[model samples]
Target: MNQPLPQRNEPFRPGETALLLVDMQRIWLEPGADPSHPERGPDHYFYRHTAAETIPNQERLLKAARANGVEVLHTIIQSLTEDGRDRSLDHKLTPIHIPPSQPEGLPVTSLAPAGDEIMLPKTSSGVFNSTNIDYVLKNLGIRYLIVVGIMTDQCVDMAVRDAADRGYLVTCVSDACASATQERHDTALNAFGGYCWVADTDTVIARIEALGKSA
Candidate 1:
């Protein structure tokens, strides 16, 4: 059996951990010309504010993770094909309009991974459910994950639960994540506090910088 994860402080063994960027793709981050889900509406005020707070933090966080030798991984939602068959009810019916359907080249709004950084294109909220991310993480000896992304209430929450269950120490960077609205964001963060330790981007960044300096 695999070994258990470390307590918060005891983890972070150089190359043995990673920073995961979840669903920061343009379709999710920026409002499209045509709203995908008419019900959800073209990204509202809450989304704009959330993005304002999250995007910068993630950009800084990713920078620190890279300089410190922590593996940087990104996840983007993309359909395997244009056929609506592979998508869920919401995705099938709601058409995406921004850069429409295809995943755009990153470095979007100060957040983009280096060519060496791995990009896991997924179709589900739980990154593990749709990709070989778990296998890749395990191969890299990554027993802990620092997660930062868009929509803290949905994709981030689902990924955290899955990661913890799979025996990886999960750290949810609160400020580096956002929801469509503050209410939803706070709800998910506070509700799942027990499942994972939620942290701030500044604190995480300092820790990474300090550790990198010492090493």
Candidate 2:
């Protein structure tokens, strides 16, 4: 059997880390988008929110990470053309639609980082696959990645796995990510825990606060 990777014992070092927020678009949250799937609608209401509810937690993580001087990187699954010609086979299979320009200057989803934050566009699930994300992270000397976003089982999982494979310390804020169902979200978290630090929003907040104090 392969030896297990060691757990991260030390708290996050803010300056060396970046927070990556993945797709959290309104199209995935709207009621009529999937009428047959009630979970994706606004009615599931767990913890005063549904499975589509991840905006507040994402916003909190973004604020905390920014306050501590951690780099913020936002990723959206958009194609290079209006017809989505650059989309990957996986994207083509999924119903998520990303026009070439929807994420324009406004915040359609909690996915957008602030104006100063780095914005990366990807055609595949992992941000590093078709984008210059790796180059930008390398140039910034970022070695730790904090991931928070929508669809825990898809883009977020892919990004976390890729980051770990690339030798970055990865942390996934469970409370800040969501999926269409509890089963999907939980399953992904369980699998991801083997590769990355699976943490709650409170834990991440405390870690960021500690890092801020140390700085």
Candidate 3:
């Protein structure tokens, strides 16, 4: 089995790293019609739910990342239109049911880029796949990526692999991520361990806080 890259015990370089939050929308959180299986109706079969089950912990990480002045970027996997022409094959296989136009204050809403937070609209698995994320990161001179959010095995795994391939230092906050099943979550984390640093929420937060104290 591939092991995760070795992580230094110290905090990441705050000035050159950012926290990427992926797919935390309400549609994924609440019980609703499964876009992947619309024929099953809203109440049929087991539903794939978000880690919002662990929202408090996720929120803690977000708060810590923000307080440390790390750039915060939010990503939502929604198509530009209903037809989803912009979506990749992976998206077509497991579709998300977002409306043609995402209203303001909607769950998974895009962040305003003016606040040093870039909102990346991705129609695919990895954030780097069809977005300007690479350019933005390069422009900001960022070399490390601290990733958090839902579906540990899917989107998160994709991001970690792609980031590593691009030669960026990557880390996954284990406790801050979730999946439909513990097995799925473990599988992704183990796979990611081969390509990125994996740390629990507390460890990651402590490192970030220490950075604040030293600075």
Best-fitting candidate, measured by TM-score? 1
Query: Model 2, poorest ten-residue lDDT window?
Result: 44-53
Residues 70-95 of candidate 2: C-alpha lDDT, one tens digit per residue: 89888876677888877788777874
Across 1-215, the per-residue lDDT of candidate 3 in tens digits comes to 99885453335886877788877665565455334434543343223334333455667777787788677787876777767776787777765435447542134322223355677777877889878898888888877788887789988998888988997888888877787667888888987787888988788888777757766
lDDT by residue (1-215, candidate 1, tens digit) is 99974576454667677999987876555555224434544458655674577888888898888889889999877666655456555554554322225555243656777868898766667888878999999999998799988668888998898998998888999988888778888999998777787889888887777768778
lDDT of 1: 0.76
- Please identify model 1 stretches exceeding 4 Å from their true place: 1-5, 9-11, 37-43, 88-90, 93-109
Question: Considering only N, C-alpha and C atoms within 3 Å, which residue pairs clash in candidate 3?
Answer: 3-193, 3-194, 4-193, 4-194
Better of 1 and 2 by lDDT: 1
State in Å the error of residue 42, model 1: 9.0
TM-score per model over all chains: 0.85, 0.84, 0.80
Q: Is candidate 2 or candidate 3 better by TM-score?
A: 2
Instruction: List candidate 2 stretches off by more than 4 Å.
Output: 1-9, 33-41, 44-53, 93-97, 103-111
Best by lDDT: 1
Clashing pairs in 2: none
Question: What ranking emerges by TM-score with the best candidate at the front?
Answer: 1, 2, 3
